[model samples]
Target: MRLLQVVLAAVFIIFQVLPAATRAFNFERPCYLRGGICLKQGTPDCEPFRGPCRAFTVCCKVKGLWGRAAAEKP
Candidate 1:
């Protein structure tokens, strides 16, 4: 019984607690729509801009949808 408890506790710490502690949290900034562009609905498009969405700025689309855009290199 004691061995089982130790094994379970070790597994929990190694698989759960350790990963959580060492994981890096990515707080992505919300994308912003550029002005002067009309937004549509249905189907997500992140064209004209490509790749992962930029920090704090959203990908622009004719339709308002979630899509990835290019992240500027530092």
Candidate 2:
């Protein structure tokens, strides 16, 4: 149980610290450049891609889309 608690705590710390690290290094820019979005974990259809998206985030694609769509949202 202690080991599990320690692991959970470490994960929490990584989530907390990663955002600061990203701000310091501008790591999020690269993810944007790659057409990936960083979303909080458990968002639907989130498939992992390489990014600095902290421990609680998942780097996901915009469903095979690039640029704006011709169809308008009604």
Give lDDT per model, in order: 0.41, 0.55
- After superposing candidate 2, which stretches have Cα over 4 Å from the reference? 27-74
List clashing residue pairs in candidate 2: none
lDDT of 1 by residue, 1-74 (tens): 99999999999878886666544332222345433122221224433332234343343423344444332222
Mark the regions of model 1 whose C-alpha exceeds 4 Å error after superposition.
25-74
Q: Per-residue alpha-carbon lDDT of model 2 for 1-74, expressed as tens digits? A: 99999999999999999999877765342344255666556644544433556666655555445432121111
- Root-mean-square deviation per candidate: 9.5, 11.8
Using lDDT, give the best candidate's number. Answer: 2
